[model samples]
Every structure is written in structure tokens, then in C-alpha cells.
Target: MSTPESCIVAGQLAELGHTSLYDLLEQACREYADKPAFSCGADSVSFTALRSHADCFARYLRHEAGLQPGDRLAIQLPNLLQYVVAIFGALKAGLVIVNTNPQYTAPETRHQFADSGARAVVVLDKLVPLVRSIQPQTQIERLIVTSLDDWRQPQEQGDAADETRFMAALAIGRTLPEIETGRGLDDLAVLQYTGGTTGVSKGAMLTHRNLLSNVLQAVSIIKPGEVEYGNEVRVSPLPLYHIFAFTANCLASVFTGFNSVLITNPRDLDGMIADMQRHSITLFTGINSLFVSLMAHPQFDSIDFSRLKWVNSGGAPLNLSVAQRWFERTGSVVREGFGMTETSPVVVASTGNTPYKEGFIGQAVIDTEMKIVDDQGQELPAGEPGELLIRGPQVMQGYWQRPEATAETFTEDGWLKTGDIGVIDEDGFLKLVDRKKDMILVSGFNVYPNDVEDAVMRHRGIRECVAVGVPDERKGEAIKLFVSLHDQNLTEADIIAHCREQLTGYKVPSYIEIRDDLPKSTVGKLLRRVLRDEARAQVQP
Candidate 1:
């Protein structure tokens, strides 16, 4: 499946003539000049205005801020109209955007700023206090602060000691002359940090070519005639800082001309529903947990999904029950996909044409290649579960400043070693088994947490659950299950009894903790490492 010529064809799918995201943005502005590029709350920007604003900001970076090509600029904001402007503006200045999560704590924020050597940060006003404290500790020299309401009304320029307000920067930027960056494809564009699920967070270095290719790859999955460019509204609830949303929603919108409705706070289900009601949403992207949370909302049935054409699930495993409930209620199948931050996020996805099947992640997109390999690095036969390795243009150059890690992650042949175990069928469809690191050993038996969790999710009373391996005396390691429930009446014994019917004795949880909540990442992916750490700490030495 992975031939040199096929790879060339895949890269060509993006029409490299556009070269970089900056080129694509320029083309989008020209082609869809008057179209709504992005909307958040009451503010919306047309492609023409977006280009003008971006140009102004780019000028500010070059002349006022003295930022040059390849300089790292951190953007710490929610899904606001300003976020879109800052992205294009930074790109125009040839700045590498370090997408920092707005909710990041002081330590997390400091580490990213320090690690990436960010010279400037565009942060939300509320989060400025944290950034203020961490600024002196890092190389950050400029602070461009913005508020949620800043887009609605331009704030008067502030003479703050160490910062420039966002509106003020744009106002100042508008007067500066545009600087030709001469930056394009193959140049690093973003430093997307991994979730640090395994250990410390590291930035995945993504170039323009990597992201652009993934954008084309994602758009290609729609197939021709499925979408009407410039006539679609995408309801994007995922955080833009996440690579999944960065490529699939933000970057893809540039190429497809779809107006993206940025959901600033997806947790506010009522507000999200209101946004959905306001826009005739044609595309929706979310993780499995978000889908479940939305379905459980009190006014879920009140929202109109009649215009919804496609619903995509990624970032985590899609539970069969959640997917089924979504289809039954919304009449849209929840097509699942698999991606990693290192791959500019989208490696494989289930398209609209794919049949609805449990655990099916569909096939690799136009230019990507995937193979299953055993512990010895030998390729596994079709239908055999093993570690999944990927090779594609979308794959990142490497982790930033972590040469040892980057070296360890790639094979001598150039395939990226994805720690997740998966099986590919003869027909090319893929099914994820579990993370290789998350695999549990129970008295000489190999137990995958996904299998155990999938079985437990089958019970009608369960809302969400995660399985982790804990140190066991007799068994090498035992499964520990943590769950949040729909029916509070269901006890730990009931879950165990139910799992017993579906899984073998060793696969059943040795202990069940019925909690009101479970630890989750910002994206709503359950943090098995957090639970595992807690479980191990409780065990006696």
C-alpha cells in the first residue's frame, strides 16, 4: 500500500502549487472574499475583512513588534473570532504559532512558553494574570491581551506597563506597511504539544506542508459533490489549540470556504445548542464524550439537526452505544477517525460512504500509509492486532528540541511508531485494539482495557467508564475500572456481574470504583494514566 509513487500522488492531492497555509489563506480570501470566514457569539468576519485584519496584524508583528520569520508566537485564547484573526495574522508574519490552551495552569503554561522559546503571547484577558506571573520566567517579551467582548467593541488602546491590548495592536498594526515574509511550505508553522498522557508534554513540530496535506486529506474524505464550498456552516466545538480541530476545522475551512461557528465553551450545552439553532450547521466535529454529554442534555431534542450532513468523532474511542444513540436521534452516523498530534492530527478517518460498524476507524486517506507491526518490528498480517506505524506527508518533522525522543519514535525506514495497537482488515478498514502501554498483564494473560471498557459500556446503566492496570500480588497486574453512571442505583457488584457475562474471568475488573466523575483531559478524553497513578499509589509496597 505504501509505494513511492503513491506517496507522490497523495502529496499532489493538495496541489502543492498553493505551497503554504499562507498561500491557501490568500487564495481563500480572493475566492471567497465576501463570505463569512468564522463566527463566534455575536461577531463574524468575512474573508475580505479577515485578510485585511490579518494583514494589519502581520504588519504590526514585522514593524512594531520586530518579529521576523520563524519566530514563535503563542496564542492562548478560546474559540473566538479573534482566535481566527490571530492565526492568519501570525501566519502572514511567518510566525510559528504555539497553540497554548487557555485553561493551562501556571506550570503548564510556563513549561510550554519556555520550551518553545515563545517571544510573544496573545492571551485572553482573564488568563493574563497567570501569564503575567510566568512572563519573567520565560523569554516572552510581548503580551497582546484580548477579552471575550473585545470583538464586539474596540477597546481604547491601553498604555499598560508590559502589555498591549488586542484591539490596540490591530489599530496600531493597520498603519504599518506589509512585509514580504517569503515563508511557505516545509517551514515549521506550529508547535502542537502532545497531551502528555505518557509523560512530559513535548511539542510536535508541524510544517506548512504537513498541515496543508492533512487539510487536503481531510477534505478529500468528503468525496466530490458531498459538499458545497462557501455554502456550508461547520459547528466546531473542539478546542482550536487541539491538532484535530486545527487541521480538520480551522485549516480545512480555508480550502473549503466553509464558515466555522466557533463554540467557545462546549461544556455549556445550553449555549452550544443555541449556537447550533442560530446556524444551519452542515458539519459537526466532536469527541465521543462530548457527543454523549450533548445527547444527555435536557434540551437536546429541541435543537434542529435537520441540516446536519456530517458528524465526525475523533480524539478518543467512539463508544458504540453513543454512536448509535446519536444516529437514532440526529439521523447522522458518528464516523470515527484515528489521528495523533505528530501526524498533523488526521491520518485515517471513516467517511460518509463507510458502513457503520463498531470500532471501525475506516481507511487511510489519499496519501497516507499504515501497517501493523509486532514487538520485533516485523509487519503483522492482515487481521492481526499489533502496534500501528504510519508514514505520510502529514507526519510531523519531529518533536521540538527532543532529538532522542524523535529518534526513538521513528524507525530507520521512516515509519512513525504509534504506541496504539490496531488491526487492519483485508479490505483496508482499521479497528483500534488498545494502547500498547495501557495493556494489562493478568496472571500470564494479556488483557486490553478497551475490551473490558467496551463490555462494561454495553450495560444500560453506565454512562462512561475507563479501565487501567494496577499492581496485583498474584496476578502481575489487575484491571481497575472507574465509572460514572446514568443510573446511580447500579452498584459496583452489578457492573462486575454484567462484565462477567461479556468478558473472561481475567478480563473482569478486580475492583470497581463507582465515582460521580472521572479524570479527563481538556478534550474530554479519559486520562487512564491519572487513574493508574492513583491506583498504584494506593497499593502497599
Candidate 2:
């Protein structure tokens, strides 16, 4: 058992070998083979069963599907047992896994599939139509679809029937071409897509080493003496496609041999509470909104919180009022963290038992260097707000197919410019003041103003448009649009209706303002700060 300070100074936090994740699972299976590894409702997968299933699927992908090393396989399934099995199987077969959100539309899915040059896709049956519509436009040559009931028994069967449709798909793939095995520690494992501040989505190439490094760094932060390995229970409700959950919840749990209770629909708070009670969950990882919702739920008071040991929050800033109320009720502190899609998504986190500062995002992780720089890229002294830059083993290799964009993201000295405005205090804790770019964070999802403006400008009646974020009580911040209409007769409803068709639900503007002209800079660039100030003035009275 080692202290957090000792672990940080020891510099033992680095990338694990490619085989380390699997080897840890083997050890867990050997020790606790009959113990549950994952559970959902009445369905459960034991450590032994999960490892055996992963091995079977890995062999199937290598021998039957003809998938070779470096081949890309896009996964568009929700949180389920198959999601873990597919990801581990693909990695074991030496294939790069590209994660796609199940909520993506046909165009969005096509763009990622085509860009990654993926040869095959594994998706849910409900989303098969979205994939089928995009298949003609993508390079995907094979499609494997699984139903929601593939692993669950039918109502008439009374939960006793074994649904083997999922297993059958793996068997079919195994009976089909033999592919070469190319497993290596330094091989590429994941291509995580991120929407840059410029509103362009690029794939950040993450190798096995990059992911392994993040997992080791996260493990080091948790005081080993405070928590026991193999006996700890974790709840993972965040979407697995996002890198934040992929590393902290999924990979970290696997590395420590903990039982992870997966929640497919986290919005079902009542069901989540039931699962928490059943498992006596010790560690819970989620975003700010999730914690807020859980605390506000009427049934929240019924759940016993004494068994909980750790609570981790990320993706967005935590609300101070919510944190205080949560601690009052649960007797546990919410450990806030910060990171992005480029750094394997875990750069810093607060200690589990420490008293939390309202706005600080904690100190840098082990084996990582962080500095704040001005617009000219010169490092700034402490207590000054500047762009945060980071360099570490967990940093991504580069963006896929966009060498120019990749080069611009990193500095000449190889540090990754995070585009976040923050200041470091004397204690090394960083406080985020604002974002360098005009990216709006609604709840926890990143919403680019340019993406909304682009969609709004497509309307025939709209002449000019700009989007900004305004403070909101529930969502942290809500999207607000300022527009000049080409046709004076057009109303705000008309503009919102047009945007709804082109943008996602979260990206649509919640408030609309009509203006004859917008403020601009000497270079004719839109001054979003002026618009934000105008919005603030209207609410001050």
C-alpha cells in the first residue's frame, strides 16, 4: 500500500504492456472466477464467463472474420455486455477499434466510417437502418447486428431461457477466413473522434500504450490502502464512446479487477438507485449533471450511502451548491477531474477524502507536465490565467488523416495546447476561468458555436447568425442565438424550427435575439464576447 504523495514522487505511473489488461483479467478470473464482473437487472456475467467469452470472440474475429492487424472495426452499440466483449476481442485480434455513438445519424455515421476506412461494423439491430443507409456511402464491407434481447430472456420465458443470438453471431464469424495475429504493446488500439473548436471532427489516434498509461496514472491516484482490489464494486453509467468513461470507468475497473455495474440508460435514475442498492456500489464515476440529477431525485434519500467509498466527476465543471448538498446527504466528497479527448481524458483528479475547493480541478497526474501559456505560447507565472498545455505518455499520437491540424494542436516543443483558460495556484491546483475558444458546454457535451451558426445560416430568411452560451440554472449553460433576418417578417420560432432540422437537440438554441447588426472587430471577425456581455446586461436589471 502506498500513499498518493509517495506514488506521485515515485514516477511508477506509465503505460502498461499491451497484454497487461488481459493478463489482469486472467488473474481475477483465477482468483474470483465465480464472482460477478458485470450485471444489468437480472442478467449477469461472471469474471470467468466474461474472460472466456472474450477469448472465444477474439478467436472468432481472427480466424473467421479475416480481420487482421491494423484493420478498423467501427462499434456503434450502447452500453452492454457485448460492448466490452467486442472491444476486448477486437484488441486481442490486433484490430483497431473505432467507437461511434449510437445516437449518430446516417450522415454522421457515414463520415466516421468513411474517414476511418473501417472494413466492418458491429451495431444494434435498432440502429441497423441508420448503418444500412450509410453503407452505400462508406467503406464498410461487413455488418453484424445484435438485438436488445440477444442477451436477455423473453418475458414469456421467465428469465430462465438463455438467448444465444449474440453468441451465435460470434460463432458465425468464427466459421467464416483466417486472419493473421499481430498483437503488440505499442500497436494502435483506438481512434477517438473529437470535435475541435473549429467545428471540425478529427480522430485522435490512441495506441495501447496511450490507454494503458492513463489507466496506470488513474490507479496511482487512488490510495491502495483505502480500497481493496477484486472486492470493490463500481457503477459505470456514462456512455462508453466518450474517452472520459472509457478510461476512468471501463479500463480502470478492468485493471483493478473490480465488478462494474453497467447502466445502459442512465436517465433511469430509479433503476440506477436500485442497482446501487443491490451491488452496494463502492466507486461511482459520472459527470456533473449526473450527480445533480441523482441528488435531486425523490428516491435519492432512500439509498444508503455509507457503503460508497469513492465518487469521481468529470466532463464538465461541478456546481458548488450541488457539491455541498451532495456531501451533506451522502457523507462523501465528489472528486472533480479535468481532461479532453486528446490526453486519454484523465489529466488531474481530486483526492477521495480531501476537502474540495469550489473551483479547482486538482493537481496534474503523475509523470505528466502541465504549464499555462499566454497567446504567444510563452509560459506564464502562477496566479495568471492562460491557455493550459500538457505533455505526457497518455497524449495522443496525432489526428487521423489531418496532419496539418495535428501539428497546430501541439506546440513546437511537443506540448499539447488544451485551449482552456485556467490559472494554477500556489498549491498546484488549477482553476478554470473560461475557455479560449467559444465552445459551449451544455450539460457535459461540447457544443461548438460555429456548428450552430452554420446550421442557422442555411435558413433562407436568416442573413447572419452567431451563437453563445448563457448561464442556466439546470444545464450549467444554454445556447443562445443572435440573428439578423433577411426577411423582417420571419419570427424567432421560424429560425428555431430551421435549426432543429440541421442540428442535434443539445446544439439547438434555447434563446433567440433579433438584431439589425452584430458587433465586429477591426479584422471583421465576430466578437462573441460583446454579444455575451449584451446578454448579461439584459438580465442584470
Most TM-score-accurate candidate: 2
Query: What is the RMSD of candidate 2?
Result: 4.8
Model 1 stretches astray by more than 4 angstroms: 1-16, 195-198, 438-541
lDDT of 2 by residue, 75-159 (tens): 8887888888887777767789899988775656888999999988877877777787878888786666666666774222111
Q: Model 1: how far is 431 from its true place, Å? A: 0.9
Supply candidate 1's per-residue lDDT for 397: 89
* lDDT of every predicted structure (CA atoms): 0.83, 0.77
lDDT of 1 by residue, 171-258 (tens): 8898887688668777999999864334366899998878888887888788678789988999999889878888888989878899
Q: Give me the displacement of residue 94 in model 2, in angstroms.
A: 1.2
Which segments of candidate 2 are over 4 A away from where they belong?
1-24, 153-166, 173-181, 353-356, 487-491, 522-524, 536-541
Candidate 2 TM-score, C-alpha based: 0.90
Best by lDDT: 1
